[model samples]
Target chain A: DAGVTQSPTHLIKTRGQQVTLRCSPISGHKSVSWYQQVLGQGPQFIFQYYEKEERGRGNFPDRFSARQFPNYSSELNVNALLLGDSALYLCASSFPSSRASDTQYFGPGTRLTVL
Target chain B: AQTVTQSQPEMSVQEAETVTLSCTYDTSESNYYLFWYKQPPSRQMILVIRQEAYKQQNATENRFSVNFQKAAKSFSLKISDSQLGDTAMYFCAFMKQGSGGGADGLTFGKGTHLIIQP
Candidate 1:
């Protein structure tokens, strides 16, 4: 079966522009989370939504926001992008019923470049 | 807050040799879970091995295993007979147990780059 899937594998935007990345979770998965990974650093959590509700949020700025759909798909939106915002945006999903610490599977990630 | 740590920035090992990546984490709660994730050049994060806080026996998955010390909050991954395909950035992660936080996902370490020489 297919694992997680992400759209717009790569994107380029200028400062102050907005971008939205999408992700489709594995079949039957109900939880989705977003992370931002700057070059040379590990991913930092952004937002997490489960069953279409905000389950958790990271220490990110107001420019970052996300929403999960009823079908378990998710979207991560960044507003007023800055050059420092250029990074890989990763989407991960998991099933809460049968959970493991790392059972969360990740998509290939969206490579965002801001000028 | 839970925090995972990986001290080694990079490591190299012969194709047939073995290598161990160290990971330690800090958590106030006693019950939790630890994980080792591998991210290749493709940038898709994959689970390598996992350890439950309460389990006494260390976890093993074929050539992959973990040295889990619940008391010390230490969890290290060991890879035997490394292969070129195993080269990736290794991240140590932690998830607090039953935190009711739902989908916070995992707290990851800075990660270590593992290179397998062929």
Candidate 2:
């Protein structure tokens, strides 16, 4: 089975521009989460959606938002981007379960460079 | 709130040698999950290993193993028979157990960059 897939591997945006990153989860997966990784740093959680509803949200600002579709695909949107917003946006998908063993598989992140 | 810490920013190991990457976390919740993720140059975050807080026995996957100490809040990854493919950035992450099958997104550490010498 194919793993999580992301679109527009790399993007360049201006300070005030908006950008959208897409992610298609693995088949049979129902939860999708978004994370942002700065250079030399680990990824920071942004938003998590399960079954097209927001299940969890990180400490990111209002400029960042995400939604999941019925098919379990997701999109992360950043508005009024700042230079600080430049980083690798990652997408992870997992099965809906309470067990800790349910692993979240990640995608090749989309690198967003804001100038 | 939870925090994962990886003190060593970088480490190096010769081929076929064993290397251990250290990680310490702070969390108030008793039921949680810890994970070690590897990110290669391709920038894909791969799940290396995971340990549940409630489990006393450590978790291992092939050449990768984790020494999980719940009391010390230390979870270390030991890679045996290291290969050049092991060169990558390793991140320690934490997640709290939520109710109703919902998940608390991961809290990650400042990763450690591991290099394998040929």
Q: For each candidate, give its TM-score against the true structure.
A: 0.96, 0.97
TM-score of chain B of 2: 0.96
Model 2 per-residue lDDT tens digits across residues B1-118: 8889999999998999999999999989988888999999999999999888889999999999999999999999999999999999999998887752335789999999999999
Which residue pairs come into collision in candidate 1? none
- DockQ-derived CAPRI band for the predicted complex in model 2: medium
Residue A110 of candidate 1: its Cα lDDT?
96
Best by lDDT: 2
Q: Where does candidate 2 clash, by residue pair?
A: none
State the DockQ of every prediction: 0.60, 0.66
| lDDT by residue for model 1 (A18-53), tens | 999999999988888899999988899898887898
